[model samples]
Target: MTTDVIVVGGGHNGLTCAAYLAAAGLKVTVLERRIVVGGAAVTEEFHPGFRNSVASYTVSLLNPKVIRDLELPRHGLKVVERKMANFLPLDGDHFFVGEGRTQAETARFSQKDAERLPAYWDRLDAIADVLRELVIQTPPNLVEGGLKEAIPELIKSAVIGRKLSRLDLTAKRDLLALFSQSAGDWLDGWFESDPIKAAYGFDGVVGNYASPYTPGSAYVLLHHVFGEVNGKKGAWGHAVGGMGAISGAMAACCRERGVQIRTDTAVAEVLTEKGRATGVVTASGETLKARAVVSNLHPQLLFQKLVGPGVQPADFVERIARYRSGSATFRMNVALSDLPRFTVAPEPGDHMTGGIIIAPTMAYMERAYDDARVHGWSKAPIVEMLIPSTLDDSLAPAGRHVASLFCQHVAPELPGGRSWDDCRDEVADLMIATVEKHAPGFAASVLGRQVLSPLDLERTFGLVNGDIMHGRLSLDQLFSARPVLGAGDYRTPVKGLYQCGAGTHPGGGVTGAPGHNAAAEILRDVRRRRI
Candidate 1:
């Protein structure tokens, strides 16, 4: 059957795009390869009776506009902010941020650093506010075509310039530094304490596989803070029913708008007619037709694997070939018999209801990255543990709990022809042991565990080499140059084909801004009969 548009994946962004398109009175259909909807944002029971958000576990970056537009809350999507934002149990000392006392927490390391905290936040919030405004708008595409194309592209650039012009001279300088400097360098200028810098620098390497000293990493640090939870700026939280609830709500909103969703139906190829996307050919050898086709897959997967050869220009193909992707990420979820008892703060309190970070200082974070560059994984990996079950009891049974371990600095591809499957258990044990060092009983408390190596993430979620941001968030690969330079406004080199995933503008983190912006552009084209 033919439809107005066919979405090639059922990721949260795909569901989001479909919801918006259908709500605009277009007929949309979504096909998902998995049994469920939420691409990587799914929650599942890896150990029987213990369900947790498998991939995109935490919530803070989901766009609030998407929440209100989709009526997520009415559809049973709820998020509870963490009582405390982060807990860093160090060697004989500890650091805590959020849940108030932020100044007090910083003062524990250095009084001067405590005094500088407000100015740091003021500068950060100013730059973050500018990015917040830019996230939902389509970036200009300056390459390809003639003077006709150049005119509109120039107009779009001016519009963005007008927005950036609102920033004061100091804020503009701050923006330039963040976009160009290393997270370590930037933090070194602001705070003199290792603990304070480490606590804040962790954001620089969340999905990034780089060192805190990597240039352009401060922008990654800023990327994580441009989001809010429940109207509180920069506050992280847990979804009531795990991350799946966010996508479940999006799927419901799409269905409510009369969109058809088919699960376990993978599209094998994107069909084109004289260079325009017509529809797709499913893995089952069934052909489906649509006026326009939207891909929510990573740009690499969509262009390299799905679209047939010779359909794209040689220059564009070369540029896409050069598009860097991969991450040093390894994800795990453990079923716990009891909560972790920390050595620094053994007694349970507000700290238990937030993120627990294992890497102590900037030196430790750098060593983890350097070690992973040589060995397949870090001897002392960087780990962030979130006991979402503390706030949402629905994840585990009775008194038991579940924890998501987002470990980093594991090479995306193991060295010397070693396979992750061969050493996954060994690596997982080392990670648990790392946590065990901080929280003595952590290893014994694990009833069972589920691990996703970088390769495993690629095999399971179509995140090429497991780069969760779709591509590295470096300066050359973000905003108008994302995916490619000539195709940043959701439209592709091929007509009637579009991208609405993390690979596009505002890059990654379940923000749904790419989907929201892509839909707006798609609707505009549809209204103009261009697709």
Candidate 2:
């Protein structure tokens, strides 16, 4: 069997990439290992009558350009912004950060911090704008080029530099700090309130195993805000039919463009001949050929497993081996009898609609990470609860609700040689208990539950070490340095092979920027007859 392009992994990004290629008149085929496509961004019925976003919950970073180009709304994709942004229930009190209430809310904790909040947001937004431009554009290769071929990329770099140059000294410094400083230190400079800092600091540690004090964590925070929902910058929304709706819509677009999709067809290995990717071999030994191959798999998985040994340069192989992955993520979905009643908020209102964060202070977040480093899991983990059912009623039975509990600080590889299968229910209980402490009777409200530990995440969704962003979004592994320097442009050393996954530039999330950008580069190469 043969095609123009074979996208190995029908994740949202793969589908997005195939859609673009097909739109350009290429005959594209997407191969997915799972019974259903969408990869981690799928909604499944975990409980009898409750459906929830199994891996990736909520929507924030999905690229608006992808949405506009794919005409997602026409394919039944609707993202409804949460009435609130975040709700932090501290000791005996609560804090809310939303569209209009942030200033007033911060004032209740520290008036000075309240005054600084707007500036902090403005500064972050400025930096985000600079990053937003780079999302769809290919990262300029760091390797020096000859005079002729280097001109275009050099100009692109200059334009990016000019954008950065527009910032004032302080904003410039803040931008630098965001790229290098710890989230704790960065937030400490702007806010005095721990809850306020915690509220903002949570972004720094999402899907990151490190503490808020970890260097380069501030960039992770920035990565989360680089998206907008319904034109509202830094806002997150719930897809009406869960995260699958986003992928489903992408698949609809792909199919409309004549891209062939085959699920439950696992590719065992990438077939290569003479240092160029020719196609793939399925687990069932079916060989499929393509003019060019694109991988939407995590880098380590692609290089270490599928591509395997002796196919690429040893140095390149070593770097791929060293690529950092795995996080403290533990996902839980529950069929709730009723909504959680917070000790502070004590009601099912705007606070319930937004992300209900359990990490109250920066120190607490750091301690959680510290404990996980030593004991394999935090005694008190950070939890982000989202009751998507509040906005989308179709997910649950009548009057019943479903809640997504995204917890962290559990080691991907447990200590004492413990397996996740042995401790899955135990960790799930701990997560429930932790939430119950804040929202009394919360555990009692659970009608049924589904848990995905880091191990489960890797085994189920093929998330290497369960790192949702593919690899760590650290400075050394980001931008032109991502998944190693030479391959950061989405082009591997092996010709005819390209990467369009979260492992590539712009990192992860439901955002299809990596796919869109990779497709752009692939199209350019194909048009130039370079591939």
Candidate 3:
């Protein structure tokens, strides 16, 4: 009935936070509304025989410190380093962007471009080194006069401020442009190859309705690029046994550390006494007490629903109301009898290890975005595909494979009156048909399929409007501006309560930086109290 901390939402970040707190010897309990422990990063059996990671398919951004600190592998977490990352099918043969042979294979398409690849990669490494500073540190508040006033509240605001002020003019300008300019424009400035540009550009719009040409897209690209797989920078890789394996490992680690986990237990409200959180009330009329409560829900869902009205500042409540989480996404899982053969180039085998990006050029990507803008759905949307079975034998029957397709331009809440139930099947067909163009027998090879739209995503995982990162990963909604301006730190408006989820600093992706940073902040406050 009582504990030192009650963590709401059994997502990976929540699990990580709980495990760390438990490691610190605090009594912790995690309450998950779903029957399963994994939140979005889950693996499920959509068909009787086929199971695949339903929401989050890859694992490149999870902080290594968490893994090392928790010794997750000791608790049944095994990360199979994806030997291959992505294979983009083009025309029929395809171009690849993952590990080993794909690099040289990509070079074969354009020798000059190939020769420049290392330099390009090296530069990204250097830039990522600078951007890496951001991964650990909280984003600098951009509020006007914010530099002065917000400083007093920051734990290391001065340190981050000095690092930021140290940026050379061109680097500063370029960094600003990278965060503000569309990924298409930014990549266009870097390369001439349509495939390379498209490959990188796809990341910029992964969770957004905006086109690759939209401003602030390059930031997404950069943020995504900071992640590594098997210790390789800017590379993407799959979890060994569907995404759920990672979550399961985290949960196991939490349990190993003596953290109590309660699945299917929903929090109806955060019970506060004189404006300080003391515990939570379950929807089932059971009250569990805790010294502090942490919510992984979106700020809107937190204050608006759980915190109750009048608990937050009116301005904060209004800002939470305005938080945008409309993601134009649709997810699909298919059981395939045979590997898809594409018309692009050297076929899909060698390149399939990497993600398959259907966008061939910035122009092509923009037109796809424009389709959603005008038609409310892409006539030819951008599709990113990964066959985890190609690397992980556990996802499908022997020789059988599962393909997880992430499609864009299908608006979460589409313009006009269209809902997902009516458009779900249609969206799945469009994605398959697109793949069919590249791989002639892709549709026929599919034995069964599971389609999830933004509505389904929101409904299933409590993801705000189905926006996976708690809310949109936009500049306005990121950093101190995240969820709400002037509240970027883990600390909420309510004293003693803190946030440690994707809604906090550094925004979304599998990165555990937010959880780590939040805990440090809380521990600091606790230490001060002891003093």
Candidate 4:
């Protein structure tokens, strides 16, 4: 059947694009290679009656426009807001973090930080206001289209002028420091406690290949802090039934709006006609035609594998060739008989809503990165643990909890030719051993565990080289330089095609801005065709 649009994946981004396009009365069809929808944002009953989201742990950055556009809340999606932000555990039972709706909980760590918290919020609010303005507008492109592009250039400049007016000189300096410094350096300047430093530092390296000590790692922390649920900063929540519930609801919205989805149908190739993307060919030798083809996969996967050679510009292909997104993050899911007992906080409730950062100090985290730089996996890896079953009962049998562990400091493509198949179990053991330092008897609680290295992640979720964020959120690779140095405006060189995934403008982590902007671009393109 001919369709108005054909999306090559059923991830949240693809479903998002399909839903919006279908909502606009355009017939859209999405093809997912997975058995279920939601590429990374998926939940599965891997352990028979125990459901857990194998990839993409939390949900705070999903754009609210998606919720309103797809009416997600009305369609069986309940975003359960966790009360606590996160908990950092040290060797001597000292745990410190930011929590509660007010400053008192923050004051428990540093009275001065408690007092400065409101000021920080106000500052971040002002910066966020600037970021929101930037997020909505198209990222500027220097050398696109003809001379008439001056009008868009002028409008973008005006937006910048207005944004600059919102910040004072001091605020500008503060914003720069917040985005440029290391999270450990910035937090250490404010808080004396190592646990407090590590708690905030964890955000810097969450989805990136860098360590907490990396020069621009603080920007990642800022990126996460910019997202809010109900206007509260740094608060992350989970959708009931696992992260997959989010994409499922989006797919349902698409279906109700006349969008068709086909699962387990992998696209073997992207059919191109005269340098424009036309549609795709499935692995089973079936072909579907469409006016506009949208790919939600990483640019590497799309251009390097699916889309054949000679259609893309030689230079563009080279940039994709050089793009670096290889990371050794292991997304490990386990069925636990019960919540693992923490040596420090024995009470189950203490660690229920939040994650436990295994790295106790800044030095320890740096050492983990050092280990990755030298030995492949960390001697003592940094692990973040979440018990999703504590909040959502549908995830597991009664009294049983499911744990999702995000571990890092292992290289995805090691130089020594050590494949993932040989390293996965050792990586899992390393993660459990690190967690065991804080959560005693953690090894025993696991009834069944599934470990995924970068190669495994690439096989499962199609994340390029297991880099979950699509590409590193490096300073050069972000903003206008994302994915490539000059293609951040969602417009690829190929006509009738645009990008709208984590690999685009705002980087990654469940944010729907890339998809939203992509749809808006296509709609604008359609309108221009009439003019």
Candidate 5:
């Protein structure tokens, strides 16, 4: 069978790309390996009668352009903002961070830090505004293009430069520091309170395996705040149905535009001839041809595994091999008999609905990373607990709830040659015990629990090393350098082949910018017959 374009991987990004390409009057077909789509952003019933967003639990950074273009809301995609943004429970004292409570919350810890909080936020917001402009853009090539090929890009670069030039000296300095400095050091310079610093520093290490003191981690912090949920900048929310609803809606939009979607069809190989992607061969030995191919798989899986060896330049192959995908994420979903009662809060309130962060101090957060660096997993790990059931009752039965536990700082490759399969339950138990420290009855509340170790993530979701961002968001691997150099614009060295995944520019977190931007580039090339 032949089509205008073949999108391998039917994940959210692939679906988004297909939707846009089909809207442009292309005959697009999406092939997915899994029985259901959505990739990492899926909601499934691990326990009977309880459905939880198994992998990606929260919604933020989903591009508004995607929502507008796909008419996602019309397809039953609704994102409800959490009443509170975050809740940090300390010993006998707690800090609740929300739109109106930051100042007061910080004041409870340190007046000096409290006074600096608003200014700090102002500077961060200024920098975030600058980053917001970059997210939608296809990253410009670092090397100068030929005069004929470069003029349009030069104009776009100038527009971006003009936007950056508009920033004041202070904002520029802050942006540089954020892009270069360690998250711990950056937070330390602005705040004296450990709780205050921890609250802010936690963003730096969400999916990262590195410590808060790791250089380039500040960029990860900035990467997260460049999102909005329901028009609230940097806010996170629960998708109405689950994270799957986002991809499900995108699939509906694609189908509406006459795009063919084939689930349970895995592409065994990307069929390339003479340095050009022709189409893909299914695992079951079926061949499908296309004018162009857009891969939503991680770069390692796409190039090293599917495309196989000796196709690309040896140097490029080595670069892909060196692409860092270190992650420390262990995800869990628990069917709760009842809501957890926090030792500090003791009742169901705004904190229960918001993100409950267990990393109370910067030192504690660092120690969690330190342990993972030394051993395999952190004995006392950083846990970000979200009880989405507090807001959305559709996930569970009457009075029963589901909680998504996103834990971090466990080594992707454990020491002593131990497999994740051997230690998965142990890690899950430790994570539950860590939560039970603050929320006393948390362990008892688990009617059933589903755990996904880092290995499970890599095996199930095709996340190389289980890095949730697909590739690490380190300075050497971000923006134009993402996945590898010379491929940031979603076009690979292999002609007629493009990448549209979390491994691409702007990087990860349910943001469809990669897919949306890749489609724009693919469409541009298609018009010029470049494919």
Candidate 6:
């Protein structure tokens, strides 16, 4: 079979790219290995009567342009913002940050921190605005090259420079520090209260397998805030039908544009001729030909596993090999018999609908990371619980609920030759026990549970070593240097083989910017007959 473009992996980004390509009048086909599409953003039934977003839970960072252009709302996508932002339970106290309540919340601990909250938001908002603009645009090649090859890159550099130039000196300083400093240090400079710092610091380690004090963590913290929910900047919300609803809507949009999606068809190899990607060989031994091939798989998996050896440059191969992957993430979905009653905030309120964090301070977060690095999993693990069923009733049985437990500080690969398969249940119990400490009856309320170890995450969703952001969001692996310096523009060294995954510029989350930016580049190449 033949098509204008063959998109490998029917993840949300691949679906988004296919939609755009088909809209441009190209015949596009998407191949997915799983029985269903959406990749890690899918919702599944983990228990007899409990269904929840399996991998990626919560909603934010989905590009509005993709939603608007694809008309996802018309395809039945609905996202509602959380009434509160975060609920942090202290030893005998609680802190909550919601609309019009952050000041009062901070004042409950420190009056000085309450007054400084506005300045912190103003500074963070300024830096986020700069990154928000950059996320949708392709990163320019910063490495020196031949003059003829350098002209377009230089132009792109100038465009990016102009955007950065908008920032004043103070804003520039703040931006640079975020890219270089630790989240703990950065928050210490702005706030005094432990609960306030811990609430904001949690973003620094969400998909990142690092401590809050780890360098470049401030950037990870910054990465999470650039997203908005329902047009509200930095506000996180729940998709009415779980996270899968977003991808389902995108798939619908793709189908409407004449894109063909084939599930359970895995690509065994990328068929390249004379350094140009021509097509792919399926796992079933059928060869599907195409003018261009787009990969939404992780860069390491695509280049090392699928793309044949000796096809990529030696330097490029080495870079892809050395490209860091993996997260300290251990995910779980619980079928709760009833709501968890917190010790500090027992009464039912809007906080129950938002993120309930178990990490109470920056010190607690650091200890969790340090413990996991050596022991494979944190003894007192950090966990963020979100009860989506509280906001969306369709996910569970009447009066019962489903909650996503995004636990952290587990080693990507265990030490002492221990396998995650052996200890998966034990660690899951530890996570549940940790929550029980904060909410007395949380353990007994769990009617059932589905656990995904770091290894399980890698095997199940193809998130290499469980790195949900595709690759680490470190300074060395971001922007022009992502995946590697030469391959940052979504165009691989092998012509016609492009990357539209989270490993590219803007990096991770449910955001379709990589796919959006990649389609523009691929279309440009098609217009020039480069593909």
lDDT per residue for candidate 5 within 463-500, as digits (tens), equals 98888999899888888888787777898878899999
CA lDDT for candidate 6: 0.93
Candidate 2 local lDDT, residue 334: 95
- Name model 1 segments beyond 4 Å from true: none
- The TM-scores, one per candidate, come to 0.99, 0.98, 0.93, 0.95, 0.98, 0.99
Two-way lDDT contest, 2 vs 4, winner:
2
Model 6 spans > 4 angstroms off? 142-145
Q: What is the C-alpha lDDT of each candidate?
A: 0.92, 0.91, 0.79, 0.79, 0.90, 0.93
Kindly report which residue stretches of model 2 are placed more than 4 angstroms away from their true locations once superposed: 144-149
lDDT of 6 at 528: 87
Q: Score residue 175 of candidate 3 by CA lDDT.
A: 78
lDDT of candidate 5 at residue 428, scale 0 to 100: 95
Count of clashing residue pairs in every prediction: 0, 0, 21, 0, 0, 0
Candidate 3: stretches off by over 4 Å? 99-116, 138-155, 162-170, 345-348
* Candidate 3 structure quality by residue, lDDT tens digits, 1-531: 889889888888888888888888889999999999878888998876788999988888887777788787787766666566666666534566665554586676667667777766765566676767777666544343555555655646677666667666756767777768888888777767777777778888888878888888888888787887666676667787788988899898888899999998999989988778889999999999987888877777788889966677788878888888866788889999988877664354546665778877678778887888777678888888888888888888888889999888766677778887888898889999998888888899999999888889888988777787788878888877876776787777776677888888888877777777777766766667720
Candidate 2 vs candidate 6: the TM-score winner is 6
The digit string of per-residue lDDT tens for model 2 on 1-531 reads: 989999999999999999999999999999999999999999999999999999999998999999999999999999999999999889999889898898998998899998998788888888888779888888877655587767867887888788778888988888899999999899998888888899989999999999999999999988888888988888899999999999999999999999999999999999899888999999999999999999999998888888857878898999998999987899999999888888888867988889999999999999999999898889999999999999999999988999999999989898899898999898899999999999999999999999898988998988988899999999999988888986788988788999999999899899999899999999999999986
Where model 4 places Cα greater than 4 Å from the true spot, the runs are 96-98, 101-115
> What lDDT score goes with residue 509 in model 4?
82
Indicate the residue-level lDDT of 388 in model 1. 91
Weakest lDDT window of 10 consecutive positions for candidate 3: 140-149
Local distance difference test, candidate 2: 0.91
TM-score of 2: 0.98
Better of 3 and 5 by TM-score: 5
Q: Write the per-residue lDDT of candidate 1 for residues 343-395, one digit (tens) a residue.
A: 89999888988889998899999999999999988999999999999999999
